[model samples]
Target: MTTMFRYPVFPVLPGLGQTDIPEGLSRVRSIMAEPDYMDGDSDELIKPKKLLNPVKSSRNHQDLHRELLMNQKRGLAPQNKPELQKVMEKRKRDQVLKAQKEEQEAHKKRSDLEIELMKRRETLEQLELDQHKDDEEQENTPEFVKMKSNLRRTKQEVDGQERST
Candidate 1:
């Protein structure tokens, strides 16, 4: 048996044309829309944005760093005397002096080591000279020559004994 109740279907409506607009709701277009209400003069009153020129275009960090470095170079970075600033300056001075003292000590140690090395080298040279002089004297001595000949004669006698045995 067929069902008598049916599902409802919705119909699609066409879009409204331009002429379909109501006269009471007509669209308006302005020729001079208030010129965007610019605050250019107020911007001039404010601090200008720091622009990195082509000559210094690589300065990508903040301008404050450059300003501080320049001021420090000119000895103007530090403000009016505060106890903390005085303490920091004193600390820096102490650290610099300490570093200088340590460097001097290191230099002194290096100089002492050099002197010791020179003394050792001189002693070695003196020993070498004494050895050379002893060698020259031994070469010139008749007793040394006779002893060498005796050693050779003993070695020959031992060789002859070994061959005979």
Candidate 2:
């Protein structure tokens, strides 16, 4: 003998594969839809939610940090300065201007020094060339030796006078 119930108050989905449901959801949904279902605790029905963009929230926090730092340096919020603040600003500006002028003067002095060094280098090179030419011309000339001796004596006398003064 077979016993059949007239109406299943909540339908019992047959173990799956005998229905119109999609393959993926067939097993899970069937179990869930069971009338006498007690799979586990009731709370497990809902999925554990998560944020899609954690960095987006961090980006907002970064904006707050930037605002805080900016406010700290430039008085509160909108850059409004009191009378003393204005005076301090003017003082700072004056100091910066003075520093810039000093820097310009230093640069000018450096350029002048470089120019003087170049000129001295050129003069030294010219003197070396002249001495080399004189040496070449003196190979057979006796007067060249006499002239060199006189020049050496003159240089020594001038150095002696400078040292004394």
Candidate 3:
């Protein structure tokens, strides 16, 4: 037995291989193809021959240069007088206040820790005293003494029974 199959093939269009070029790109290409285009004589092209001089300022260059040198030597840029000083003083005051607050907090913590330690020591001493009192009370009790003797007697009786068995 033989199986036969047919596949469909689409025909290629005439304009399918052509792409639409933009008008600007075509104009740019035509301009670039001209022999005199790179000479930069046209107003549309930029010229590198034009030199732009820096605008002259009213201030003296030597003074500005000396000020820059001084600022560099000082390791800081020139700032307004009262405003910068006030800001620096405020920062220093804030730092000092923060340090004082931290020191006070640390001192309070230490005091609290010491107080807690003292309380714990007192509680431990009280517990020890109570334990000592309990021990003395137990020693003085007739019931505890009787229980000790009864335990010894019971142990002897159990040993005798085990030997007989």
Candidate 4:
């Protein structure tokens, strides 16, 4: 029995107007002239010179240098995983603190909004009370004589019934 693992390798090609290259790969050659789209037959042909350029390696070296500097600063005595863990822990703690601060600010905003709503409600209640008073005064005016006469008639009916009883 044979166990075989075959991984599909997909070549990332450049778009219509540009050449496809890895993220850090720098093309020293000017892209003034565009290459013709290679047909299926020409796809198998590998140009050694084109593949030999280490533009990506140059970028990786820079990233490696940066990592080295960070390690030096943290005094990561080579292969010591504890220091890396400490750095990661510190980062997590910082993120948590930042999130907590944001939450506190959100809470404060909600409280301020609640206070404003309460104040508006009080103002609306006062306005309603003032409007009610105005309505009462209007009802008492001379033009409201019909309503006053109706009330007197009802009172007379009640008094006459009481005397008869």
TM-score of 1: 0.24
All-Cα superposition RMSD per candidate: 21.7, 20.6, 17.1, 21.4
Per-residue lDDT, model 4, residue 4, is 75
> What tens digits encode model 4's per-residue C-alpha lDDT throughout 1-165?
996768433344465334354445435333344554445456657644656557646988779778988999998855657777989999999999999999899777777778899899999999999999989987777856867888999999999999999
Clashing residue pairs in all predictions, respectively, total 0, 0, 0, 1
Would you list the rank order by TM-score, best first? 1, 3, 4, 2
lDDT of 3 at 153: 100
Candidate 3 lDDT over residue span 1-165, tens digit each: 996657432333466422343335553453344556576677776555855445433357657777889998989766557687899999999999999999899777787779899899999999999999999988788997879989999999999999999
Report the Cα lDDT for candidate 3.
0.75
Question: Which ten residues in a row are the worst by lDDT in model 1?
Answer: 28-37
TM-score versus the correct structure, for each prediction: 0.24, 0.20, 0.24, 0.21
Best by lDDT: 2
lDDT of 1 by residue, 98-144 (tens): 99999899777777779898899999999999999999987788987
For model 3, the superposed segments whose C-alpha errors exceed 4 Å read 1-110, 143-165
TM-score of 3: 0.24
The C-alpha stretches of model 2 lying farther than 4 A from their native spots are 1-110, 140-165
Query: Higher TM-score: candidate 1 or 2?
Result: 1
